[model samples]
Target: MPLSPKPDLSIIVPLLNEQTELPDLFQTLADQKDILFELLLCDGGSTDTTRQIAVELGGENSFTTQLLDTPPGRGRQMNAGAAVARADMLLFLHADSRFEAPDTLSIALQYLTSRQSVSTHPVAARFRLHFRRRTTHPSLAFYFYEAKACLSSEDCIRGDQGYMLSRSCFEDIGRFDDSLPFLEDLRLAKTIARQGSWLLLPVRITTSARRFETEGLLRRQIVNAVIVNAVAVGWNEFFRELPGLYRCHTETGKLLLFPLLDGIRILLASFTPDQRRTFWQATGRHVAANSWQIFFWLDARHAFHSSLPPESVRLQWTNRFNRYCAPFVCSSPVAWVASAAVRLWHRAMLLLCRRLEPVTKTS
Candidate 1:
């Protein structure tokens, strides 16, 4: 089959041992209408028949499909896929995700181009996620996951959210951090958010929750929360402890320790001058977002699991917190000092980044 000079999108999937999952993914991609796309499967040394299944699926489909080989690891496989992708836009999807709508790609591209027209910089986005199966009646864990995706904040976009971005913007951010064994996608989202708007599209991509089921839903959420926090704090050491800490019997996983926190200490003192400068910039960006989030969260259960207006819910909660904390937490001298210190740190990082920007640009 002849290929376009540039496809509208290149869907990159990093496959390991997903023989059974390939056909459904390929079929779903095949069903996409009114859009041009190339599906590139980066096989990471699959011992199963995943490669054979992929090849057969490609032969059966009208769309362009390629089964490429790579070293075992999602980061390496995705980077390898990106290296050869022939599209101006790229989407890194997991093997277990599938587009339920026939026009999902077309709709997603329209959303991207529409947003791009209004923004001065490149736009990246991800679909809201839906689990393929519900494990029991319903769990608060599911609601929390849904809320995290729906939140207007860019930081909440996770790997399973179906990342989509133009190739140029992707390249500018230097692509995914292939160095990490995990949380590469989360880190990539942060980098993209820094550059421009990171959108969470209303369109939903259903993904397998088999891992959550196997690992235990609550336990998986705990593990995820830990891993995400570790990435944010750049605590490489904590991550080393994760695979074992959360290792399921088939499953299982804080703040205020910053001075002693391995990640924070490394950021402040252990890094080289250049590394420290990068850390400072990242720190400033992070703290600004983090500080807002401290106030953004509401204590009410309805705030997280409701169909009510998000702002209205947040505003009411904020009023309640201010009324309560003002007479207690904020009244104490120790509390005042701690709060002021945090505020000062955020301001200091901002000014430091401003001072360093010129030197970084010229260098």
Candidate 2:
């Protein structure tokens, strides 16, 4: 494939240890011979021979390929690739992402071209996304996320969908925030939402769900919800701490318990409102019985503190306790009893505390 005098789009893939996935990714891009685009593979210091393979694949495919080196961060890598890119449009892709159909790039270009012809302002586009190799009957979590993205219009977007933006728009939105440890994609989407309109293309892209599989899908979703809420609520400290917490949990093999915990969450979620209320009361009793152990662990963990924001702390502790309590709650018939007992104890305790409150005296 010969290079065009001026490529219409520049495809930048930021990669790290993507040796196994690079072949399929590059092959997918190379198959789109009709799409005028330049391929830029920005390597984030991969110890594997990904760089060498990228070079070989580029030569075999005969597309304009430029291999770039950058520090190991997705934002920095993409920015580095974009700095040297020559196309008027930039499409950022993850190594494991693939076009859902052969016409994806062409359709994307048509949208951009049509938008540019009519509008004076810069335009951006993102494709609909689905997890690759999903079952015919996907999980509830899958539907939950996909529906949320579509319903949201443009407020939320997963990076795997691929972000296509004109050079002007990319610069105007201030580009991707490199300093963020993660969620740079969503951050960019939020910025784009504020700056201009987002073109939600009907075309879809398939992204790898390896992480969700390795870590329980539901647990990952819950974690994502907590982090997204943290970002929404301006609790930046909690957001910053999440990476460390994830690392700690992974090293300790705590992630193995996520599937079980998530299963219990699903089971509890399936209950009717009235049934849930009854279960919660039982859960309270169970908690009260283990109050001493809970207190000891909290003391050891230094979980109670006045300095940290109360809401943030509460959110973290609630999730942590749920993980530990899920196993007990999964036992036959015990969860119902625990929830009822716990609810009753909680009400009594609240009533006593309210009764003991001091009254103000007027002069």
Candidate 3:
């Protein structure tokens, strides 16, 4: 199995304590057919045998493999991997990501290449994500998320979906933001949306749902929403002060949301009146921008009930809200109202978590 002199794609995966995940991930890479790709395993100072496992597995893989040592940040690790890639195209994937189809990579590259050839502007691609959970039970939350990932909406194109773009396009978008340890993927996704266009590739990528499973699904989503909201409102201090609030997936357990909510409240209290008002206003605008989710949820609900795919039902209500309602909701007065609603919702969630935590622990 001779590697291509110049691989068709460079697959960059940021790793950290992924010793357990390496063999399966390596096997998936090895299974990729009809596509020549170089694997760059960017290690972020893993204390485990992650680097060693990557090296040993790389030796058996058909494609070219390189292990890079970088500081402990996903953005930095991915950027380092991209720096020395041999291919014109780059695919960024998580270590937990797996492909059911051997031709997944081949199809994705062909689709992207074909789209780029036809379109005047640059096109970036992300796979439709399917969460491989431990349970087989139906969950509306998971269904809604799966549906949402299929959209080109803001904050929808996550790293778990596996981003694919040409090296030139990536360069134009600039390096993944290393300013924070989180939201780097969201930042890059937003930039790509602004500069070019995002295509939801035909192939589906299965990513582990360990985080959501370990830390109650609804609870984890609430935390994620809070984080995204904080980012939206430019609450930099929230992240700076509560740096340990977001932990690694493997380290996650039954998430206690009360402490995090309390910390946020404390941070809010510390702000001046003007700054507080501005923060609330920004939060309102962010909420209004994502108001389409409510309508999309309605669609997802319909799909869920019918046992149909998420995108099966096209609801024009979301479009109507975006065109007519979003502007009005973006105003300061509406924003203030939105802010109040959010505060009330947070209080409700705090109470609910308090009631549920004991039961969860005992059960």
Candidate 4:
């Protein structure tokens, strides 16, 4: 309708071997109201007839969809599609990820259009995601991503978070790091966050349950955590040691950011500084702080106001900021000012920190 004018957004999805889902995904797009955007599907060496299937879907819908040939990695596929996108915004979606509600795209576009650019955009934007099967387990992916985000800018956001970026912003910062075979999304998410604001709402995206079916819930969760830690510590290759049981997808359920991951760090920090010293010295050898987490992580999260953000999601993880933050409705006046001042000081120190850490590799 309306000749698909110039297209308001570009939705990029990296497909591996999913042929059956294309027809439904395309139909959903067709049914969407006034959603004029180009759907660029990147085929990552799909052995199946996924490419042919995508072509047929485009023909059936009478809309513009193109399949770009890319390497197997999701980051590479997204980068390839970004290189060709004509819209101002780029939404990198997973092949199995589906946004069922028509308002999903509409709200996303509105959010992006409203924001100018914050120095730190919180790394990634995700609406709640519901898994078809394990609809019960909340997504641990958010916690992992948020935990990673606090440690450093490069380690925060990963592809699993349903990526969205401004074309200009992406080009300015450069696309996802193709060098990253696994956490390219993680690295890019931080980069985007640093450049501007990362926004999220109460919306939901429904993804497939194939991962949960393959990996028993709890074991799969460990695999997910291990992989995240491996990537965080520059041991991405070692994650390869997992047996066939983990080689397949294992994640499911909608992701709830903000609290899941951040809350844990807060709880751990409850130990006093001396207590942390004693605890880590006694147990440090048992666990690895290879990357060495931030100093603030040791503080008892509840030490602050009741409304602080946990370590993950990074949404309002900072104890002081979340209280006085505009969205929280009511907060202590002293907290309002203190959090503001602390953040200001943090920004001032960022230059020195950036210099010491060489920008991306270290915390």
Candidate 3 whole-model C-alpha lDDT, 0 to 1: 0.86
Cα lDDT of model 1 by residue, 183-284, tens digit: 678778778877777887757788887777765575455446445655765757555533334332222211111111223334346567876555444444
Best by lDDT: 3
lDDT of each: 0.69, 0.67, 0.86, 0.57
Please write out the lDDT profile of model 3 over residues 235-330, one tens digit for every residue.
Answer: 888888887878877677989887787677677888899998888778877777677789878888888888987656566667777778877876
Return the lDDT, model 4, position 4: 55
Give the winner by TM-score.
Answer: 3
**lDDT for each residue of candidate 4 in 1-363, tens digit (9 for 90 to 100):** 454567888889888778877877787677666667899999878878889999888887755798899987777888899888888888888777777687787777666566545433433355545555545554444333333433333444445447766777778877888875556776776667677556553455656657645544544444465455445534433434322213323233322222222332343356578754443333222123221232233232332233333332333334343343333322344334443543354345444444543333210
Q: Per-residue error at 16 for model 2, in Å? A: 1.2
Off by over 4 Å in 4: 1-4, 117-124, 134-158, 236-363
Candidate 1, lDDT over the whole model: 0.69
Which of candidates 3 and 4 reaches a greater TM-score?
3
For candidate 2, the clash count comes to 15
Model 1 spans with C-alpha error above 4 angstroms: 1-5, 134-136, 239-363
Candidate 2 regions exceeding 4 Å error are 1-4, 239-363
